[model samples]
Target: MILINRLRTVLAVTAVIVAPSGGTVLAAPSVPAPVSAAAQPTAPITLRYEANRRSMLAAGIDRPDGDFLLFDPNGRGRVAQVFGDLSTARRIAVLVPGMTNRLANFWRGVGGKSYRSPAVQAADLQRAGAGSGGFAVIAWLGYDTPQGFDEAGRANLARAGAAELERFVAGLVAVRPRATIALLGHSYGSVVIGHAAPRLPPQVTDIAVFGSAGMGVDDVAGLGTGARVWAGQSDQDWVRWVPAARLFGLGHGAKPAGPGFGARVFATADVHDHDHYLSPGTDSLAALARIAGDLP
Candidate 1:
């Protein structure tokens, strides 16, 4: 009951008792439950995205370029960086990058690299839909990506990273339950998504793999999610040469960009090499923006 009703009853009882005679007086009753939705946490879990953002900037662990959705201080640092307004967004785009990505370079693009950093890519995707209040692009470097090309040949990191990826998706769903989520996994990250696909929430509507070595699955149907699967390839991407076989656990199975991978090989113009899919004005980037915005 409301506190006012309880106080009124207490006053009535006190009037009939010795309270009027200066004997025993009743104390104010306590409130049972908080009335506002902001009570405790807004959701089942308190992501504290805003708190973490401020903390990272103050400590120099992150930059002022974008917001931090989730951040880990230990070691090389795992993070989820947001490029647009996530709380009010209708669509969400998650960018899971490939090898050699760490907290230090999460936003800083490396010099002479074949592709742009995850941060730049995410920003580009966000700007693509700025007219319609586009998706909240997230650069999720939440796993220990392989340090080099040689270490990337195996699927060990992807196998171990799958659980965390699934949890991250669940957390996003908790915060934006009605938002349409799209997953974009580059290189070895594809294998991580492949393993996590079976357990992904229903809110996820699309999964795209580009410059992937392999997804560790024979076909898109094998991933077990209802989301549409897409693969983008460029003429210069060296990942095409990576063996599509997972024999003896040496590599991820079934190349996603290959002809028989069973994913939609959608429009990919200006495709240069591995990691160039996010280049501005590229067909792949445009298509990706559409997928995230749920636009045709």
Candidate 2:
């Protein structure tokens, strides 16, 4: 009876995440074509930042202190805000967030916690790596993220996000050229990175994921990227309870941090939960900063 009850609970959770609303499956949003490497924008980074800021202000996004390289106020919005001087930086990090992230909660976190906000997290990473000099971080929200569990459980949104991420990285490489890049993703954003891994440019040296659902691969070799893979998950994170296997197109594959996944598992001992991995003063943040700065 206990086993049956547990099975039922698992099924219920899966239903909540994968079942169609109103008994009809909605079509996934169309993914835009990737911007080719040669076609990526070649404008000066500062000029692009200023232009984007002006556009954001015109659209009433109200980020007076923000340094945005890209901003589009359409739908849930798309933005890439830099935390340091990109033009002079030798090390660059791009952070991709997870579900329920929209322009509405871009600056302030979804639940109002500074640590959970993409902008704040990027700033924290920037500060942590400040000693390395010439390190910059970009809080990149260039894709339409899944808004709820139903969408998060599926891979469609992640695949779409991967395309956008690929295009953005191409543009970044076109502009920076010499900077070594690191990619960091939290939760479903890890899925996006996983899908983008095979196509990413050689400049990306590391790929780190925390609070991940899954990377849609059984192991690191399956990722098909030369970049070193890192994974972290706090003991208290609720994501540990999520099923680690992909089911009938509903779930992402094995947890990247789990044994045999072949990722360098980092310590998140000071992190409290899913949202706190990037929090200031945590071991997770320090490790992530090291990865971003290309420090061993």
Question: Pick by TM-score: which candidate is best?
Answer: 2
Q: Which lDDT tens digits does candidate 2 get at residues 65-140?
A: 7777777777898778899888899999999999988777888989787677899999999999877589999999
Q: What TM-score would each prediction reach against the true structure?
A: 0.80, 0.85
Model 2: runs farther than 4 Å from truth? 1-41
TM-score of candidate 2 relative to the true fold: 0.85
lDDT of 1 at 283: 91
RMSD to the hidden true structure, all candidates: 10.7, 15.9
Q: Could you tell me which 10 consecutive residues in candidate 2 have the lowest summed lDDT?
A: 31-40
What are the per-residue Cα lDDT tens digits for candidate 1 across 1-296?
58878777666544332221112334445423222221112332223454454456655663645566666655766777788888888898898988888777776754535256888888888888555784788988888889887678777788778888887888778778888898999888788888889999989989998888888888887889999998887868887777778777688888877788788886765887777788888898888777766776
